[model samples]
Target chain A: MNPMQRVMTAMGQAEPDRVPLFILATMHGARDLGLSIKDYYSRAEHVVEGQLRLREKYRSDCLNPAFYAAVEVEAFGGETIFIEDGPPNAGAPVLRQDADIDRVKVPRLEDCPGLQRGLEAIRQLKAQVGDDIPILGSVISPFSLPIMQMGFEHYLDFLYGQPERFDRLMAVNQAFCVTWANAQLEAGATAIGYADPLASTTLLPRAFYLKTGHRVALDTLPRIRGSVAIHLGSGRGLSLADDFAATGTVAVGVSAQEDLGHWKLAAGKRFALLGNLNGVEMRRWSAEDAEREVKRAIAKAGQGGGFILADNHGEIPWQVPDEVLLAIRDAVERWGHYPLDWKE
Target chain B: MLRGGADVDELSSDLRCALESLERSQVEKVLEAAIRIHSPLEVIEGLIMPALEAVGEDWTAGKVALSQVYMSGRICEDLVGRLLPAVAQERGSFPRCAIAVLCDYHLLGKRIVLSVLRASGFNVLDYGRMEAPALVARVLADQVDILLISVLMLPAALKVREVRAGLDALGSRTRIAVGGAPFLFDPELWREVGADAMGRSAADGEAIVRRWAGEGAP
Candidate 1:
């Protein structure tokens, strides 16, 4: 089967030719293309070129057209700071004070250069790959975008203190998320990677999120077209497995803190499981370590399909050596076959 | 002011529970009662600090959410400012300490660490967000004795080495403590980055500061 067929089969909880590899390489694409991060992410063609080159080199299944997470903030009229070594960061938060909330208006996709590049990349990649490969697009969830908008501490204060304003902000962000995700889908993305780190139980009480962030997600995900994979950066969210599955997402991205087998068991067959590998540690991993991790992950969660091998955090760090990616690729190719027989 | 002769441990436990539940009024009430009977420092060190530490411990264990711990720290910071008397002698007794977010904009960890240090009666300089060279220059200019750096990303975490080398080039004796997601994920990363110590939480940061201050070693 082709890579897209393999991923679709897994998403359907059926055994594919092999477990599909979704190496969540975003900024690393720029690194691989020998372009400065700013230059590489400046145009959709650069991103598409980087993605194609990365897939050809690594032999990964999915193509991620995402530039960086902070680019989502730019759509809200926020500025971004591009760095030499890593992903661009959101500049000074857009909402420093409560008054700034009124100034926030959902931007036209064409006006936002950062998001326009991403959408164009998706369009370009789709035209090229043509469903032979899955193109994953990403968006910052409304509940978590405030971390870049008003800052984490201030956002929490706003969340706990001013309920009405919090609702107002969520409404704005929710609209943006739906609009952005739908635009990516319309641009021919196979799925949307919904990043909502703040909604993770690590950041907020599950009960609190159920009433607040969960509602936003529930209200937003259905409006977007195509598959949605909910990823909570580095949050430990084994307990939130069911909660995430209930959010109308096709899969949930688990963190390094969760065991792959446990997450699979908790999630059951309700949705797919996309990750659990520690990307940070992967930076320092030897080839043997990479192989061992692959075998272990496949052995644990690759039982009845519904598992796409990837890192805990959605993006691979630019600092990770090329050897690590190669090792992971080779390991997955070797050990990621279906109906695997391995001991615990 | 000790209502019904409340035990320190019991009061601290109650405070921790209140903090975990995010009951701001209950936290204030507990602090007020404790402060009436004990000296301000005693109330902070014996009651408020311990309660915050418990919340931090719970957070580390994943038993409580970070929002609770963050809110608890913010609440205590406000109460500490309002309730604690200005003990001039105790205020500047520790080393000249400052906390900065090195090359990253995320300030949650730094804010919590700052609050914990202040509640523990340490005068800490808040440097806000700074890059490596600017941070090094400011530390040198301030003659900072101890520097605490927080970063959310790995690249920013690695910048700690640059800050360390900068300080060494200047022949400065400012000891550095690193904290953040990167260090917490990778043990021995602090030492690898030439930091004197690493803290997993705000409570751990305060303890490191106290230990380093007591040793009087740079």
Candidate 2:
């Protein structure tokens, strides 16, 4: 089957040729190409080249356009503090006061420089490998974007002290995400990868996630044309699987700690589960150990169908060897066929 | 002694009321009640921290959201604002410690530590969020006894090395301490960042700070 057909079939909860391996490329991809992290982030050509090399190496199904998590906030007029070796961080929130919510506006896709740059990268990926791989555009969830604009304190205060204002801020932020997602879809992105890193088990309780994150996700998911993958990057809130799946997300990405069988049970048969591999472990472990762990994850989660093999989260460190990543791909190829019996 | 029992009951009741008020997001009322109580640590550990923990539990159970957690934190801060001066007046001095966020944009951990350290008698100079390594160096130059850095994100935790490198370059003597979710998830991260001590909670941080200061760990 074609890459798009395979991914879409799996996303649609049907059997594919095999379980599609969706590896979210990281700085390790660039390091494999012998490019420095600084050059990889700053230069568009370096980023594209790195991704192309990764796509060629993994022969994976998905292509993510996000290099770092701070892109959306940067586009929304927040300052981005760049470091030599790590992902750029959003500087101190621009909107410190509660009243600044009134002035907060969603950036237009073409007008916002950072979003424009991101969209351009997606467009470039489309031109280069649109047919061979499914391009998934990354967007920060609205629940997190406001925290990026206003500091976490101010944002949380707005939620509790003045819920009405909090709702307004969320509405604007969600609208901003919708606008960006729509633009990415138009730019040839086949799926929208929504990352709410802070919306994890350790950070938020299930009730708060249901009230705030769930509703915002429901609002934002429909805005995109293609499939939506909701990544609760932290492993803390596995109990919210049903809640996450109920938001109409095509797939729910779990962390290294989540049991895929448990998620399938909680989220029901409809929700496809992706991920369980530890990023730190993958970076540090031997190729043989990496293979063993990947095989274990596949055996546990790669049963009937409805699973995508990926890192627990994005941002694989540069120190992880390319051969280790290749071992993961090889293990998936050897063992990830669908409709396998548990007795094996 | 019997009369002293009644006084303890009153203080506990007052502390409970203050905490409950905080959980309800009644910032002003909680602050007022905290002032009404005589034991500041009781107000903090008994009333404030417990309230925050309750909110945290509510968040985990899906009863409350991040908004509620942040709201509870702010309300607690409001109470801290009122209590700070009173504590300063009574204690006559605060410990010499520089408290700041290490790398992540998430500041809840920093705020919690700041409050706990203040309650534990530390004169904290809070540098807020996204603090540069250079700024931390300048603060350390003031001859602070201890430096507390809180991180939440992995990408943010990487910035700790930058702070460490900066401190090394400056040849400063201030002891460095690290804590928060990142450390909980990746314990070796503390050693990687060259922190003098690592803590898992506010109480743990207090103990570690005391031990580092030669006051004996609580």
Of the candidates shown, which would achieve the greatest DockQ relative to the real structure? 1
Quote each prediction's TM-score: 0.97, 0.84
Q: Please write out the lDDT profile of model 2 over residues B1-218, one tens digit for every residue.
A: 11245655554555445543445334455445555654665555455555555554554344444444444555555557655546545545444667787656678778766665664445678777645565565666666767788887666666777777777777766677887666765668789877778876665666666566666221
Q: Looking at model 2, how many pairs of residues clash?
A: 10
Give a tens-digit lDDT track for model 1, residues B1-218. Answer: 23344477677877887888889899888888777778777787778777778877887888888888788888888878877847325445678899999988788989888888777677889999999999999999999999999899989999999999999999999999999988877786788899999988888888888888889957
Candidate 1, A118-189: lDDT as tens digits: 889999999999989999988899999999988888899999988888888888888888889999999999
| Alpha carbon RMSD to native, model 2 | 4.1
TM-score, model 1, chain B versus true chain B: 0.93
Candidate 2 lDDT, A1-344, residue by residue in tens = 87788877777767788778877776755576676665666655666777778878887777765767666777766777766545567787877776677778767766666677677778888998757688888788998776678876666566556767777878888888888888888888887888876567555555666777778887878877777888877555577776676778888788775676677666666678888777765655777887787777777666666777788775455545677778888877776766555326
The candidate that achieves the highest TM-score relative to the unseen native structure: 1
Which regions of candidate 2 fall more than 4 Å away from where they truly are? A14-17, A29-45, A198-201, A339-344, B1-38, B41-73, B88-95, B103-106, B119-121, B128-140, B153-174, B211-218
Pairs of residues clashing in candidate 1: none
Docking class of 2: acceptable
Candidate 2 chain A weakest lDDT stretch, 10 residues: A335-344
